[model samples]
Target: MPRRPISPQLLARQALALLIGYASARVALWLYLPLPWMLGPMFGCTVAALAGAPISGPNQLRMIVIPIIGVLLGSAITLPVLLSMPGWWPAFLVLAPFLLAALAGSYVVFRRLGGFDRSTAFFSAMPGGLNDAMLLGAAAGGDERRIALAHATRILVVVFLIPLFFSLVYGATGSAGGGNPARNVALSALSLSDWAILTAAAALGYWGGKKLDLPAYAVMGPMIVSGAAHVAGIVHVAPPTQLVNLAQLVIGVVIGCRFLGTTFREVSREMAVAGASAAVMIVIALAFAVPVAAIMQMPATQAFLAFSPGGLAEMSLLALSMGEDLAFVSVMHLTRIALVVAMARPIWRWVARRGEKDGA
Candidate 1:
């Protein structure tokens, strides 16, 4: 008998299945997991994709673009707080080593895993801007899809495990009152004027980042512009609630889209190795962060988020919700991004050369 043709209805059902798979994973993580929101969505996407969903499409741009914008908006929250501080330069000096070690350690883990190259493992494991990492991966000729999946898996594992670990080890202390200690910001609500200012900042930041080729345009751009706006007193208000929700939704949807057609069949032994490498990368990062967290006198969960080889938004979100040092996580995450970007080319080359020598 001739095989029946795949109808539009079937395609639609498949699409919905993909979406549901991803969404369910995310909702579970968002509700139950201890990780950040940004990480949850990516985790959902990977799970959905692994479950035979069709998230990966011809338009890869959407997968990469939205997260960039979302990250910018999220990171913008830090700008006003950071600018108000004294001796920002000195702060950077203190953070530089930790970030470098995180990135370098990631590379070492990647090299140790034989099937993949340094670029793939490094970009996959490097915790920073998700959008920036994807772009960097593409530029370095690393597999964007694999990197995306690896990133998603790391996020999922951390999100699912970290909170439980803390609760089991440290005991659940209710919602962690994580935020900047110095900032007298209000999260109850925001005025219309504040919303307008934030919107303008996001728009202008998007424009400027595209023009200047900044890393993680959406988050970074909006952050810089909005921060400047606050510093200049043009937008002297906190971020609005509606804008925050919108940013979360967009980021969640985009991250979820990646899980379109994932399944166990698709997860090859090599991919498993890559995932293990990513997990290893996270462990190494955690080890490096313990001393720093102790020196800084931060809580264990806060230290884990700060040092975990997870994305910036994910770690910061976890920190903020758990009532840890949001600013500290933000600064640490930014430092990691800057360090990775600065050293990406050399790292990529090193990985590539190493892979060749190893006949990978």
Candidate 2:
């Protein structure tokens, strides 16, 4: 069956919804500077959506912006960043068990407390992006909507809570929040040649990534291409802050829109479960991050973000702002995503089938 072209009315609705989401995020920036735009709209849209508002999230816009995000991620991968990685070996050794522990622990929270079905709970508890969780879970017959909401709430909680903990508990004082908060490049500094190369990388990398069937290929593909460019010293700067923020705005809108028809009662009920699951993972991550930091003789702040189950790009950017090692954090995030994507589906399927057999 052929998929019908999107209707103009629906497109318009989506646009309006995104505008609302973007506005909400902008307002949120007053409270939290680091991820104000993304987090704010995400919360607002979830509320508006659950209330049965006519607005929608920015899914269509995300397809375009994700590539730009990939390009930004790529620009962070300089040759010097690569050389600064030998000290990270200890943490990498611990990442495997950390992934499994987080997954297993969260799965129990969803299944037992949230009352999710086997497949939905399994995928819901995964620490991957909302898009990845939904696609993977739906492929294995999980409730797509439930999985989407679960993952969305997970990200919202994790991103917000991690920073708050740092600020309130640790008394960390940084001008810009997260990773190595670098100076921003004015949009005016970008030359035509710069535009040409970046656009080409995004375009080509997205196409190639899709062809290769890679996870988050649009972002990862360009990351590879752009990372190569910067590593080779062909480019020295990331995408402009203006553009990167735009990417975040659209992505947040899309995430918020995923809850368009869910009721507030339902979202609230599940959110409690999601929040608990995320909290559990945070506790576990913190426990491991300390030892890993001590063993590696690195800062605790850097190790925490590296182990944190936030989005790869979000965590990387946070690391950048917090004045941490961007390359090391990026590498850790990439490793976590790859490991989750590779293992999540197969493990869930095995568990689902086993449960079915036991019931029969």
Candidate 3:
């Protein structure tokens, strides 16, 4: 179980890619754009990778970077953030139907239009759980590689583009992790003891997350711990803006490197199908947000953020950046992940069995 030696050339390539991405993010931030730290780095490395750069991301770097993101997200929560949870219960009612609709729309695009195999189409149509989708798809005799790539593309596209939509809606009044107009941000203002306590929380939380097998535990564990500490009034500090931006940049590079080994011709059709499915899900989320938001007496923006088809970490960070309700956003995304895990695998197996019987 010893780790393989990483090539120095690979490390150098990754560094160059990150430098390009980070530089690009700085320029974008200077221009006062939304999600500048993440968006620019992601797309910057994506272009470099697509143009046939022999580059891979430093996964170890992301492991460190992602947890910082978790800490930042956690600090957003306070007693007040948890107090706002009761108002968000109604939004969960909209999630089940929204999920069904997303599955149906994705099925149509992947199956009928794209001509993917039934199993691939079915599992790929699912709106969440990339790891589960890929594994279940493979177990059902579908193309696991295609499923993985499809999801990687879907998540990358969703996280990368959704912010722009928000930007146009919310305007650029807010900024990244530092000087947040919203309370509960900026790790730099903390004292030495505060840092010690927060980092201690992070380490313990990570251990607990791993023990519990939480999705994206590195981020989630620290987040839960940090949020708890803040809610308990144990600490008032958040992760520093410099640290937050660095985390975002490295994460952007990780996402961008997802495209490194594949050619456009190979993944283009799958990407198209996946992107279409994601686009359909986005529409469905937005469509459901309006009436639900009215009924729930919440902002349409809040509803949309809850329903958005992005990862928990990315969306939570997005909500934080735009000065939206982070607690509701984080919880809904967590619920969505749970829903997908409990439902997607069994549903795929049933469909796969049904397809086999029909084909006979």
Candidate 4:
């Protein structure tokens, strides 16, 4: 299918948004804030949208950047990381229970406190797979707008809070590509052959992932291919720091732009509900993360990130910034999204049936 032609007006809006995002990033960097490239733009654009600016993120452009991030993540993988995969089973083992607990807790908050109906509350409280929740919630006769807003608010809050928590509490600070000197290669240092291989990995992996109907395939597919190449010793360096930072900037802009076309007053109550539910989920994540970290012999912060209810990409970016185990964090989030997408509908149906039986 051919692509739709973007109107000139839309282009102008995107440009304005990007400009604001860039300026915000500069201010954040000057203030020595963590993950400035991402958080700065996210906060800036969000405020702009709330203030009624004619701004919109360039989502199409962000898609083009996502593959680069996938490749960058793949570069973090190696023989040792691959070998350590088996040891991660304990973390995986607890994931289902943690998810269930998170769902139940958030459901109570949304349904009872927020006064949302069963379908809307259930879907709104889902911890991951925002797009899936919106689709399934709408199909289940829920308010799609409310579901979307809830998930978006949760994501916005989680993404905004996690990095700040790490930075202030743990004193963590670094660029999104991480602090490993070896991985921070300059763009000019790459050979033409390296560029060719990376490009192919991004293009082919994205196509293959989409063909297989994988969730978040745009990033996951490229990460898989890039990871394989790195493990096989086919690639020796990560994508340049410049490229990674650019990807972060674009992602932040997209996140902030989610609030476009809506004002704070309009969504204030829903945002409060979603924000409270998000807090509930985060506390649950922390409870799981502490024990998992002890068992995994990793930092609690890393484990917390792995279990956080933020978007996969956002958490992965945080992992990169914190110099944590990117592979582990990415895999954990990917698993959560996959499980949610696969099981959410069936579970919702079962719950609905139980509710009906109880009422009868």
Candidate 5:
């Protein structure tokens, strides 16, 4: 099937949204906010959207930017980081239990407090896999709109709060790997050969990952390919800081634009429910993160980012911005999403059957 053509009006809206995002980023930088390029755009676009602006998500642009982020993340995976993977078993071991606890706690909050139906509450309570939850929830006779809104609200709240928490509590700022002056190279610093390698990795990785149907393939594919090249010592430079910041701006805009067509009346109740559920999940995440950090002998922020119920891309970006272990955080989020995708439906089905039996 051929792709549909985008309308000029839609293009105009997208441009306007990007302009707002960029302007917001500059203001945020002037004010010295943490992760200004991202958070600034996110806040600006969200406010615009809620005010009934004709904003549309730059989905096509975001696809292009995602590969850039993937390459940036891949550059963090050095040979020693790859070798240290074995020691992360404890964190990995706790992920399943942590997910279960988050799901159960959130389910209770959604059902009891939010008054959501069983299917809606259960799927809305998922710790990850937003798309999956919406699809499955709709198929299971839940309200699709509610499920989507709940998940979107969860991502927005989690992404917005995590960085602030780190900045305020831990004094961590977003400097792209803790202000590593060496990593702040401009685009002009890259050799032509380096550009070719990076370009090939982004293109080939995206192609291969899509062919294999990997989750979050746009980002994951490039990350894997770039990571391999980095580990092999084939590439010695990261993408330019300017490009990375642009990528962040685009991603923030995409996330905030999710609310474009929503009204406060339509989403107020659902947002409240999802926000409360997100809080429950965050507490559970911290509960697990503290102990896991001790056992893994890493910063608590790293573990928290790994265990947070935020989207894979969002959490990984936070890790990258905060100078945390991007490799570990990305892997853990991949695992969480994969687990939710594989297990949520079967678990929900079992619960449904039990409910049926009890009622009968």
Candidate 6:
């Protein structure tokens, strides 16, 4: 039998349907369900996936991915500078070159992943949510499957390690009694001013995400905007203590879902390689994070979460749980992603040029 090609028009309609469904889910989640933010997207994706809805679309997944890029930019790039600076001017000084090098180095390694080209691999290897990353990868002309796999790998590693890491660092057994409440309650009580700042930061993040053409702008953009707000002394909202646990739950479910139909025997080699790369990335991140945190006089746990290569939501959740600084972690993760994506295209093009010159 010959393969039939799908015309662009039919494809567009399918995509439109998916988008409508996904948007409906997201709005419902935000307004009525009050589930974890992660769950909102997951719910949409799950419905689409289960219904055998074609993944090819101009739907919620793609929209979600765009804002995430902003989140990565905010977390990894902007927040660090804000935290490090004696003033705002000095922050940019540190940010510019750091972003350039990270993107350049990571892209070089990502391209060498055999089947995956630079864009897809870069987005896949990026430290964030799988669905969001895959959507971003697709928008950037990446192999969505590979990106999804890479994200899955990262999530698996984080789920296995974070609890253990927390145990090691905090010297607490895996028990509910380890947490504190009075402090958490105080943190949860967001003031009117704090809400204003959060809203403002979210708006800025969304705008920046759109301008920069990053993925999952809603989550990512808000993170950056809010982070910047905190740094600028416009808001003093900390992570709600309940949100820490909520974040972990979100990550665990999301990561576990990816493994549902996958067989270890089939993906063994790919899994191993992905796991190794992810571990290397995490270690390298930790190396940078510890010293940076020390230099800035930040708590080690907060720094660790800030620096951890776990997905955006996971690390942020951990930060919230430990009563660590969510603003700091959110900014760190956001920046790392933003810089890497921003710089990847130019670096890939340079590599392509160099390859052509060598071939010639």
Each model's backbone clash number: 20, 17, 0, 0, 0, 32
- Give the higher-TM-score candidate: 3 or 4: 4
Off by over 4 Å in 5: 176-182
Q: Write the per-residue lDDT of candidate 5 for residues 9-64, one digit (tens) a residue.
A: 99999999999999988888887676778888988998899888988889999999
Question: Which has the higher TM-score value, candidate number 1 or candidate number 2?
Answer: 2
Clashes of 6: 32
Best by lDDT: 4
User: What TM-score do all the candidates reach, one by one?
Assistant: 0.71, 0.90, 0.92, 0.96, 0.95, 0.58
> Highest TM-score, which number?
4
lDDT of each: 0.57, 0.79, 0.78, 0.88, 0.87, 0.53
Which one wins by TM-score: 2 or 5?
5
Q: In model 6, which range of ten residues has the least summed lDDT?
A: 172-181
Tens digit of lDDT per residue, candidate 6, span 1-81? 976777787567445444544464356445533223333334454444435444433333333333432332333334455
Clashes of 5: 0
RMSD of 3: 2.2
lDDT for 201 (candidate 1): 71
Off by over 4 Å in 1: 1-45, 54-100, 103-105, 108-114, 117-125, 129-145, 172-188, 232-237, 268-271, 350-360
Give the alpha carbon lDDT tens digit for every residue of 87-122 in model 3: 676788778888888888888888887888888888
203-254 in candidate 4: lDDT tens per residue? 9888998999999898889989999999999988788888887888899999
What would the TM-score be for candidate 3 when compared with the true structure? Answer: 0.92
Relative to the true structure, candidate 1 reaches a TM of 0.71
Candidate 2 TM-score, true structure as reference: 0.90
Rank order (by lDDT, best first): 4, 5, 2, 3, 1, 6
Return the lDDT, model 6, position 226: 58
